[model samples]
Each structure stands twice: as C-alpha cells, then as structure tokens.
Target: MTKSVLVIGGSGGIGSALAQHYAATASVVTVISRQKAPTQNSWHWFEDTLQSPAHSAQCVQLALEQRPEVIFICNGVLHDAAAMPEKTIRQLDTAILMQRLHANVAVPAQYLQLLFSYITKTAGVKVVVLSAKVGSITDNALGGWYSYRMSKAALNMLVKNISIEVRRLNPSAVVVSVHPGTTNTAMSEPFQTNLPPGQLQSAANTAERLAQVVAAVQPEQSGKLLNWDAKALPF
Candidate 1:
C-alpha cells in the first residue's frame, strides 16, 4: 500500500530531491515550502515567521489538520559569518549567536513543537530532521564556527527530546536526528574545499543517502542519531 510523507523544507537542494524521490512511491507527498512547491501533489507554503511562539502556535494548529504519516524537517541555514583570521573572541558579536540560534535551532524547534498532534496520532510515523555532523558531542576533534555548531547542537537536543516524548505518546512514531554530511549546497559551498578528497557529498548524494536513512528507521530505534548511510551516531 502507498504511504504518506511530509517534507517541511521541500523547495531547496536536498529537500527537493527528497520530495521528488518520495513522490514516486508515496501516494501522499506533501511539501511545505518557503517558495511554491510543485503543483502535482499536495503543497503548502510556510514563512520563517512561524518560528515565533505566537505564529508557530497557530501554524501548528493548521498543520495538524494535514494528518501526516511521516514528517521530515529539512530546514537549516549555515552562515559561517566570520571566517578564520577575520575575527577573534574579542571582536565577536554576541547578537550573532542569537541570529544563528534562531535560524538553525529556534525555528526547527518551534516547528517540531507545533507538529505534535499529527505526529503522535499517525501510525508508524517517522520524523527526521536535517542536522549536521559537526554537532556531534564526542566527534568535535576540530572546533570552529561556534554559532553554527551551537545552533545545530541545540537542534540535536530538541530532536532527542522529541523522540522520547513521541515514543511515549504515539509509540509508533520514530523520531530521530540525522547528519547529512558535508554537502555541496549554498550553505557549504564556501567551505567545501577544506573537506577531504571525495568527502563533500553532493545534494543529490545527500538526498539519496537520506532517503535510505528514512527507510531504515524502525519504531524501536527512536531517540537515536544516524548518519545518512544508516550508521548510528553518538548523541
């Protein structure tokens, strides 16, 4: 039988590719885009303003009406605002951290909170959020990009908590965070050269790997972190 899938940021690089990939097999492929998504299936638009508590409360009310079986949150922004040698702790702006949190952490946090009822009610629900490897607590051998790293770390915590809560409420919905690897997107284009040879995963490669990650999840595996290749990660 055909299944249902919802992609929160289905307009961008990996998200769009994922949307297209699932639409081929899923009977219900829903896309919530910042821009207009393809009209072939169910599509909706959402603005970043939904990150605010007041707006997100309302947006969540509306989204619950969709009754999704799976929810994939693919929203994130990585602005390595200060490059190396450009600034130091003495010159760092405190406000930059807040902006970074809002973009990568706060927004997705709000979205996940708002999406509760649908996720908890749906059977075999899978909620996957796009996170980064740099956020790994044990894997931080090399360190920089304080804002970006902290934002994603916060996001990782949110997903981990959500997995527990969803398991209690839904029992069928498996919530897990995933690291998509160093991808060749606008967000990582500036830093790709620093990546080891053949290490920077293309958006399509990321999406394909992520699709496999999605397929690999089971309810018993909730609250875990995984890489795109289906390998478990250290939380």
Candidate 2:
C-alpha cells in the first residue's frame, strides 16, 4: 500500500477519483488544484492557479515534506466552452493551440520541474503523468484534434526526458506516462458519442485501473508510455 501520495489537478473527475482511491490506504494524501477539494476526503489541499513557478514551487515544497511515494500529474484540457478541436489546418487557431499547450503541457511541466530535486533523491518513487494514447506519433492513423494531439505528444516527450534523467540519480524510481482510457468525464463527454460500446469508463473504474498499473510498473519500464491495461505504447 502507498504510504504517501501527491495528486496534482485533484479536483478533476478522474483526478479526484484517484485521490479517493489512494486515500483508502495512504496515510498522507496531498492535492493541488484550482478548486477546493471535496470535504469528504482528508487530503491536504493547496488551491493554486499553478501558472507561476514561484507559487507552484511553494505548493510542491509542502507536498515533498510528506515524502510522497507516489505522484500523479493529471493536468490536461481537451475542449472548453470557447474552443473545440480543429478538424483541419485551416480551422486551427493560434489562441486555441496556446491554450491547449498551456494546460496540457506547461502546467504539468511546472509541477514536474518543481519536483525534480525530490524525485532524483528519493528511491522507489513512482511518478505517473496522465497522457493520452492519441499522443502517440505512430498511432496517428486518422488525423484530427490538432491542438489536443500536439500538446499531449509534447507532454509525452517531457515525461520521457524526465524519466531518463531521474534514472541516473535514482535507479529505483519509476516515472512513466499513462493513458487513462476515455473516462466518463466532462473532458471526454464531447467525444464520447462515436466511441465503441463499453469504451467509455466511469471515473471510479479508470481510477481503479490506474492504481493497479501504477502499483505494478517496474523500474525497468520507467521511460515508457503505458496504456490503461499496463501495456507499453509507442511514443
């Protein structure tokens, strides 16, 4: 059982479920999000925009004090009320692209940057960044969702790079990007219409599967991108 855990973006659907999952056994659960956490869980919540590095650093410093054994970076955005995914290059807007990048890549990047020192020195730490399978360059058979795809692809690379660096300092550490499948959340509601039957998972189910995957991942698979079933996916 995990003794200590840190969850970023803990107010989101899947993220909140993950916090609840870990809270069952973890003695200390730390969460950072823009909204207040649900009052039911006894997690240590730090509400922040996570836009400024100095602010993010302070939140991370407090989390590290708990000596978390597991960390989840779940910050991401697909479509918002103002913008839907671009279907073609002509439909792409620079503003939408920047918004996707800022949420999917930059925000998580900030937290990872803040946790670098702690990750390098800590042994047996498992870092799981929520990435999408659509991010895979090799898996792009049908092209669409430009902004979301590009942002996730970039996020995958960041996880790969961090895994390599952290391995050299702490070989026991496990850092990998994981695709949490298409959960029944607001983020996926827009795209769920065409998904195959049973493809959409409930937030609780996704959380359970992700917990199992994180628990089973080994140090040797540190730099890989894994599916919800724990299968390694191509980056």
Candidate 3:
C-alpha cells in the first residue's frame, strides 16, 4: 500500500526533485515550501520561525497531523551578504547564522522529535534530511562555510540520536542524513565555477540518486550519514 511522504523545504532544488520522484508512488505526497509549488500536489506556508525553537516547532507540529511516512528536510542557508567571508567564521552574520542553525539543525531535530510517534509506531517509516559534504567535521578539508557546515554536522548528530531512540519504538523505521552531492541549485550556483565533470548534477539527477539511496537504505544502517551512493560519511 502507498504511504504518506512529506518534503520539508520542498522549494529547494533537490527538494523539488524529491517531490516529483515520489509523488507518484506515495499514497499522498505533500510539500511545504515558502511559495506554492507549480503542481497542485503541494501546499505552501510561511516559515517565519526559522530562528526560534517555539516557532520552528509550530511548523513541525502542523505537519504531525498528516503523519508522513518519510520526511525530507531540504532546508539550508549560506550568507552571501557578508562583507567578508572566511572559512572559519563566514563573517559571523549573527542573525543569518542563527537562522541557518535553526533551519539546518534545530528545526529538523525538533521535527524528528515531534514526528517520533509517526515513525516509531509505524512500519517502514523513514526520515531523510539533506546534509552537505562539508558538514563532516572529520572531512572538512576545504575549511569554508562554517555556519552551513556546523549546522549539517549537528543534523547528523540529531539523526544518530534519533535512530538510537527509534530502535526501542519501531524496528522497521530508519532515520538517516544524506548528502545529495553538489547540484545546480540556486544555493550552489555561485560555486559552480571550475566545476568537475559529473560533479555538478541537475536537480532531477540529484533527486533520482537520492530516491535510489532512500530505497536502498537498510534499517540496520539507521543513524548513519550516507551519500546518495549509499557510502558512509563521517559523523
């Protein structure tokens, strides 16, 4: 039987791809975006509580009523407005950084907690979030985009913790953080210069790879950070 799926931040490049890929198979697929989706399958809402826990929690609270079988959190941020950008600080746009943390790390973490009941008692439920390759604390060779990196790293931690807790609740459920690779999204458009062949993918291809990865993820591998190819990532 088909199950419900929710794509958080479905307005994003990779997130949009996810909506197209799964909407056909899922019982009902819903997307939450800042703006309305071009298709009728989604519903748009304002995400103003990006910095406050209570506000972010409210958004997730609303989603809980739908009881998504899988949730893909594709939200993120990068500061292009800073007068100076550094690998270590990124100019410390306090408001922007805080917003990034709330969106990238805290909001997803809270939603996992809020949606715990949906996946815990249900079978075959999955929660997937987009994490960046730079988020790996052990894998940070370039050493730039501090806020984005740290927030993703925190997201990984959140997934690991959730997986541990879910084992006691639902054995069929899996929660994982996936890096969708560098794609041709507005977020990455600025960095597409000097790109390597096949390294930069279209949103469609990124979505395809992500769907394949999600299809292949095993419950035994729950709590792990993985790429679209199913390879392991450093937490």
Candidate 4:
C-alpha cells in the first residue's frame, strides 16, 4: 500500500528535511508550514493566526481530510528573534513563557487531538512529535532554559496521556516523543559552540536517523520518549 505522510512545520530545518526524506518514498506527502515550498506531493500553507484554538481546529480539520497514515509534528520553538533560552530564573518572562507554551505544548497537542478522529482505530497509525531530551523530567541534571524546558515537559506529559488514550482507542496506533539531538539547524546555531566536534548533525542526517527511529517503534512502546538512535529515554 502507498504510504500517506503529513509533516507539520515543514518549512523549518528538520521539518523540511523530513518532508524531503519521506517524499522520496511515501506515496503522498503533505506538508504544512508558513512558507509554501515546492514539494514533491502537496503543500498546505499555515498562518500564524492558527495559533488560536478555533483557527487551529480548522487547520487540523483540513489535515485530517488527507487521512495520513503517518503524522509528524515538527512544530517547536527553543528561541526566536525576540527571546532566547533563559539562562537564569531572572530571565523568565511571562510573554516568552506563553510563546513557548503555545508553540511547544498547545500547538502539538492540538494537532494530536485533530488526528485522533482520522487515524485508524485498529493499529496502523503512527504519530511522531519532535521533542527534546531536556523535556525528560527524570533526565534533567543541568537546569536552565526555563520556558523551553517547562513547555517541552508539558508536551511530554501530553504525549504520555495521548498515548494511553490512543492505545485504548486503537490497539495498533502509536504515539511517542522523539529527541532529534543537537542538529546544525537555525534553532541550534546559537548553541553549536557548546557541542563537541562530531556532535553537530546536518538536518538531512538527523531526519534520516529519525525516520529510522520512527519505523522501529512498536505499539507496545507507545508513550515512551525515544532518542534519534531509537533508545528509550526516561520520562
């Protein structure tokens, strides 16, 4: 059967790479992003206005109409033009925190909720969200990036809760979070100096690795956080 794949945030570095990777094999690849890129399959241009719940629901409805077998939510924000990751508690701003929550937490969860109605109720659906290792509550050793960390942690919790509900609703459906690692993307450019020599990865390389990880996940493994190598991470 021809695979149907949907990639949200397809304009970003990792997201673009993922769309290209899947377009090479997937029967139909639908990409949603702020920019309308020339795609191998289809494109859905998203607007910032979709951040509103009602607007997002419409966007989700449009995507669900595609009936994608695999959905990858590449939406997330570590930093932006106005704000960077907080290095101390004093740097925590309500506006910045709200932005992070909307991007990393609310948006991803909205997509997941809209997807539930369209995914197979049996077992064939797979949903992957681009999460971060810093999101792992038990894995936190170094403390910083308050807004980013808090938002992602919330996202992780949503993934866990969604996984349980999905398993009950559809025995074969799987939902999990993934840590793509430190890739050479615009989002990581500011932090690249901190990474070791061979630690930084190209967007294409990370996308390929993550594709493999997604393919290897099992239904029973739902709700777990996985690294790029497919290793399970602690919640």
Deviation in angstroms for 9 in model 3? Answer: 1.1
Candidate 2 — what's its lDDT? Answer: 0.91
In angstroms, what RMSD does candidate 3 have relative to the true structure?
Answer: 3.1
Error of 1 at 158 (Å): 0.9
List clashing residue pairs in candidate 2: none
lDDT of each residue in 163-223, candidate 3, tens digit only: 9999888988988989888888878888889998989998988988888887788899899
- Residue pairs with colliding backbones in model 3 are none
lDDT tens readout by residue for model 2, 96-121: 99999999998888888889999999
Candidate scoring better on TM-score of 2 and 3? 2
List the candidates' TM-scores in order: 0.85, 0.96, 0.84, 0.91
Q: After superposition, how far is residue 195 of candidate 2 from its true place, in Å?
A: 2.2
Candidate 4: Cα lDDT at 124: 78
- Arrange candidates by lDDT, descending: 2, 4, 3, 1
Candidate No. with top lDDT: 2
- The runs of at least 3 residues in candidate 1 whose Cα sits more than 4 Å from the true structure, single-residue gaps closed, are 37-66, 80-91
Show model 2 residue runs off by greater than 4 Å: 39-41
Ordered from best to worst TM-score, the candidate numbers read 2, 4, 1, 3
Error of 2 at 181 (Å): 0.3
lDDT (10s digit) by residue, model 4, range 1-235: 3277778888899998887887777546677775655644355545434646777677667766667777899999999898999999998999889999999998888778877766546357888999999988899999999999899899989999989888777879888899998899999999988677889999999988988877888899889889999999988
Error (Å) of candidate 2 at residue 24 is 2.3
Count backbone clashes in candidate 3.
Answer: 0
Worst 10 residues of 3 by lDDT: 40-49
